[model samples]
Target: MTDLIACTRAEFARLRRWPAFWIILGTWIVLNLVFAYLFNYLAYATGSSMRMSNGQPRAILLQQMLPAAVPEVFTQGMAMFGGALMLVLGALVTGSGYGWGTWKTVFTQGPSRARVAGGTVLALAVVVVALVLTAFVVDTGVAAIIGTVQHQSLALPGAGRSLLGILTGAVILGMWTLAGAVIGVLARGPALAVGLGLVWVLVVENLLRGVASIFAPIRAITDHLPGTAAGSLAGAMRTISGEPTPGVLDILSRPASFVVLAVYIVVFAVAMMWLLHRRDMA
Candidate 1:
């Protein structure tokens, strides 16, 4: 435990100086801000122009971008960008040890293979949590400002529920981060890990989900994919903001989604540990 803590501190210190960490984090914040602005604009524009079936002006803007709706905005933004950013950062942090030829040096410093691997995972988890919290705070502040300018009520509603959603979304992203750590170890390079992880997330998982929708047999298996499970976990946040639950593709119940996410985290952690123990640093 002492060795693990020491190694974790070293990892954190290294992360403090990592330019990629700040770059990815900065990009995540900026992109989400842009999306928040666009979402508000669309809601306001539609409300100003459209009417309900009863011929009343639609309150689409208030409905979607009210201060009370800030949590929903944050949730959606994290669902879209948080997982991907976590994957990239995870890869960069773990794979860089090899890319910089520091893996062997770290091993020579007296920590067992498991201690080093465990410490790295622990450090990445801390970073993921911090990033998630930062997103919530920044997005909520941006939405509040926008709502104030639009003359909407600035009171946050359902604060408890919104917080629950944020935490759940964070956990899902944390799981993705660990999975990326495994990919980093396997690929042994940041560039390759990021490329492979993105392809898996943006291409393969998406394609599988789409195919699952059209083919009954494929649907059965695709529902069990790690990406689908993560989506299910993140999608649950929508219900807190009174949005419709995600459809057939998720298949798993909320409880089941949590279980699946836990399973994935455990499997990835075990795989990473096994590889670290069995493989040579060089």
Candidate 2:
């Protein structure tokens, strides 16, 4: 137990010291801010136009941005900003484990292989959870400020649903971070693992969806892809025209995709442990 705690402490300290961590966090914040600003502008413009048509007050403009602010925001924002950013995040978490000969030092700490891997997984999970939640909170707060300043009613009808979406979306992204860690440890070299991890999120997963589109039944297969599955958590849908639409309650209500996400985490964690056991630390 002491060793495990020590490992966790060390992992946490190492991550904090890395420049990549700050870079990824900075990018995530900037992307969200940009989306929030654009959406707010579009919402105000459309709402003002619609209100004039109906002789309603200009305050209706705030409502236009409401959808973008709520359940849809986190998922859409993450899907847009998170793809590359998440890969960068995943890379840093996993990369530090193996990059710069850090893995050797971790293993040499005299803890058993299981303890070492378990500690790393725990540490990564904690960090991912904190990051995703913090990002969502920031998004929500920013939108609230926008609505408030614009004199928009803070009481959007579906605020609870939107909040739930933000949370679930964060968890989904968090799961991917865990999976990335496992892949990183298994691949051993920080650079190769980080490269493959990025490819998995940005290319392979997306390409699978594209291929699935041409085949009729295969389109449903996107429900299994990491990105698509995770998107479901945020209640996001892609139109047949390849446009994004807000997902319905039916999509978000189902819990199966989250289960699959957990499976990914567990399987990779096990794989990481198995690989750690086989490798010689010295």
Candidate 3:
């Protein structure tokens, strides 16, 4: 445990100086800002309305546009773009150690292979959580400003519910990051790990999900895929804004999705540990 903590601290210190980490984080913030503004602008122009349960007409444009609509915005952004970016970030962070021969040096320095791997994962988790919270803060600030300017209500989802949704999104992204780290360790390079991870996320997952729609049998299997399960987890957040929920499919219930995501994380972590222990890192 002492060695693991030391390694984790070292990883954190290294990441603090890593430009890619900041670049990705900055990009995420900027993208969220742009989208928040765009969505608000659309709401202002086209305008939207819906009937409340009490049969009263409600203006949904502000609800959909403002940061007060965080559940909707957070889940949509994370599930769609943020998740993919995290996978790449994870791959790069882990694969860089091997690319630069740092892994070899670290292994030779006397730490157990498991401790080294655990340290990397711990660092990645910390970074991921910080990034996720930063995103939430930035988006919320942007939305609040917009709402103030437009004289719109800044009503938000229940605190407990919103926090739970954020937590779920974080877990999903964390899993993606770990999976990418595993690929990095196995591939021993960022390029292949990132390329393969992107293909799996963008092409393979989409293709399988689409096919599942036409064929029932395939759907059953594809629904359990990591990406699919992640989407389900994110979708569990209720969007009171009445906007259409993002994502192509959501077959699993929230509890079931959580279980599947947990399975993926455990499997990836175990695979990474196994590879680290058996592979000749020298």
Candidate 4:
């Protein structure tokens, strides 16, 4: 336990100097500011109540752009747009370690390969949590400030739930990044790792979905695929179709999606260890 903790700390120190974290964090702040302004501007244009539920004036303005519920709107927006960007950020988090070529050094530092893998995951988890927390704080602050300027209240039902969803979604988004890092460790190159991660997420997943439609057996299992399971875990909102893909039971009752994600993490960690044991390092 002490060894793991020490490794975790060492990994954290290494990741702190990464440029990827800063770049992603900066983009997150900028996006939050821009979107908050747009949301407030739309509220002003619509001349909506902008009033608190208690009939008092509000300090934060929550605008309704889509016909769906507020929580649903936020969910879809986060999953489709912000979430995608975050996925890339996740990859960058793990990939940056590869770029620095430090995982090898980590393995050589008396800790076993497994310890190094655990340290990498521990560090990445901390980074993901911090990144997501920062995004939510910056976004909420920007919206609140703008709404206060406009004399609009910013409270909404399920706001807290939506925030939690974003945080979990960010973690789920990191799965691909983690996968790529594993691949990067095996391949000893960043290009293949990034390309494979993106292709799997953007192309292969979609292709799998399309193929599953015509093949009954594939359809049976494809729903549990990484992309599908990530979407399920994320609980992203869809409007054109108000249908929830995973359903309440699937998310709350069944643990398959989470299990799959866990498997991915474990598999990659083991694979990285295997690579470390076999491969030559400088």
Number of the top candidate by TM-score? 3
TM-score of 1: 0.87
Between candidates 1 and 2, which one is better according to TM-score?
1
* Tens digits of lDDT, candidate 4, 165-282: 5545454645654665566675566566666666666677778877987887877677776666666655633322322322211322125656777777677656765775666765
- Tell me how far candidate 4 lies from the true structure as C-alpha RMSD in angstroms: 6.9
Which pairs of residues have clashing backbones in candidate 2?
none
lDDT by residue for model 2 over 1-282, one digit each (tens)?
Answer: 898898788777877887878777777777765654454455455664332223333343344344344555556556434645665566566656566776777567668777877777787677666766676667667777777777665664365665566566656666666666666666666677768877776677667766876866876666566666666654432211222432211233337667766676677678777877787654
List where candidate 1 sits over 4 angstroms from the true fold: 42-58, 239-250
TM-scores of the candidates are 0.87, 0.77, 0.89, 0.69
Give me candidate 2's TM-score against the actual structure. Answer: 0.77
Quantify how close model 3 is to the true structure by its C-alpha RMSD in Å.
Answer: 4.2
Every model: Cα RMSD to truth = 4.0, 5.5, 4.2, 6.9
The lDDT for every candidate, in the order shown, is 0.73, 0.61, 0.76, 0.55
Angstrom error at residue 81, model 1: 2.8
Which candidate, 1 or 3, has the higher TM-score? Answer: 3
Candidates sorted by TM-score, best first: 3, 1, 2, 4
* Candidate 2 segments exceeding 4 Å error: 42-61, 64-69, 156-163, 216-222, 236-253
- The true-versus-predicted C-alpha distance at residue 110 of model 2, in Å, is 3.1
lDDT by residue (tens digit), candidate 3, 195-273: 9998898788888887888888877799899888887777666555344334523578889988998898888888887
